[model samples]
Target: MTADHKIHKKDPHYQQAKRERYRARSAYKLLEIQKKFEIFKRAFYILDLGCAPGSWLQVSKKFAEDNLTKYKDQYYHRDHYVILGVDIKKVSKIENVQFLQNDFTKPEFHTHLESYFQTKIDLILSDASINKTGNNFSDHLRQINLCLKILELAEAHLKFKGSLVMKIFQGADFKKMFEKAKSVFRILKAFKPQSSKKTSNEIYLVGLQKK
Candidate 1:
């Protein structure tokens, strides 16, 4: 394999964007999905699940800027944006976003989220996945289970008409998962962003108008 081949084999857009902005490649995925779905515009309070590294928080903070940085860790103040990011893994410091280190699946997660927002969130996004074991079936199952838990959490914490975006693998439970999302959200669709590699099974599900 040549050097050029190896470089090109990686996600070209992701690499380019990351180099230019110093953000994770996953940032582009959220941006692409948001651009197509328009779920971020009206969001007042946002929750980012599995939010380590702060890419999703970066995207959301740009949307939630309110000019006053009330939260101590939240540094960027634009005028109306509020962002809360949580993950099991620790993340680097980010201005204009609040970071919480904890497992989101735990009940204690609500305490942090509620304190951050003081109310229900307008948008919830989970770009989380289990460590890939390289076994396609098991990986898919693990991802699906994670998505389900995030969905349940969203249903509990999100305000009416809020939106949710979750990353899930295309597999046996994909359809059932979509159906469950459809029941709670008025609009549900799966999108594969141009930035996402064609070979990856990862697909983003955008749920709008939470019921």
Candidate 2:
């Protein structure tokens, strides 16, 4: 086997993801977040930004299906649950989720989103990150900028009382992004899931109840 494959095989999360049939180990990050916060609770219309390799999409589909089954008797139209994923990179198909390949930072992306789901989204997730350039500071800045863009999209597209979970690299401007999120959300918290690499500075900003 290749050296990288060997390394990945030894990683516990990678092995677990294989066993669970998830596309990537990153699925565990969302799983841990859901376990802690129940962010998917009552989320019918969902959007995933920068969703390539679709591990998060898998978790979302499972959660939405479970929610539908649990509350099957409550709603007459139980057939609809909108889960859309957007990425600059082309993602392979997932059975129940929709994938759109477009630059989410562009204005035209909104037009595409509007065409798919008429109502505001109940939850917005962004696992968006810049390709690491080996310079931590520069990488952090780029990631924070990406997070801010996701926040802007959330502010415009999220339904009132909706939730947003976005990944951001902790850096000097981390507090600035936190403050921005605070202004837009009623409740905001920074979380690092155990599945995240211990050496990585990435953290998820969970924003609840859009105001």
Candidate 3:
């Protein structure tokens, strides 16, 4: 009925997500990533950063719960699913997701994560970005800096052979960031899901089988 609703209804992914009970259209992006990379395979603990609106957390919770059932008999990956979501903005609660609304760049965030998960993360997902100033270059640079910080967290918290997916903007230093990820991950690839807005420079960088 509202103009915003009409505009959102124009997007097939948005409509599909609504019908499927997902929190947002962005859910499709993670679904596509999972399809391509199998990043959820054998993952017991997942950390979702910049998880406001909680769609990725929804997807992660589903896959993590499934993994609990699927890997029940396995020697590992059978731990009760631990899915954590972090954001600077508050998110409505999702069942089974433990959320910490805080600035991840700060030290307290890492301390909370270490206390919560207890062990190294099996997969880390970050769709987080800096608040856009509507200036593309400036926003891109800030996002790149955030992506770099994510890599630092990966270094400290992710287990060997773990997987990661992060959203980044393409601009100056994009390749530099990509190569930097390459140094830490054995397999790294950039993916732009069909669900992403055509005009957006946002892309998902997937790091699999971390060394």
TM-score of each: 0.86, 0.95, 0.95
**What would you estimate as the lDDT of candidate 1?**
0.82
Candidate 1 local lDDT, residue 179: 97
lDDT of each: 0.82, 0.91, 0.92
Return the lDDT, model 2, position 161: 92
Candidate 3 off by > 4 Å:
1-3, 72-74, 77-79
User: How well is each residue in 1-211 modelled by candidate 1, as lDDT tens digits?
Assistant: 9986686567576567667673677888888888899887667678899997877887787756632344334432335567778898899878867788899888777777777888788899988889999999999999988988899888888998899999999999899989988998999999998878778999999999998
Judge candidate 2 against the unseen true structure and give its global Cα lDDT, from 0 to 1.
0.91
List per-candidate RMSD values in Å: 4.9, 1.6, 1.4
Which ten-residue region of model 1 has the weakest summed lDDT? 67-76
lDDT of 2 by residue, 1-211 (tens): 9999998988999999999999999999999999998999888889999898999999999888877766656542356799999998999999988999899999778788888889899899988889999899999999988888899889889999999999999999999999999999999999999999998999999999999
List candidate 2 stretches off by more than 4 Å.
72-78
Quality of model 3 by C-alpha lDDT: 0.92
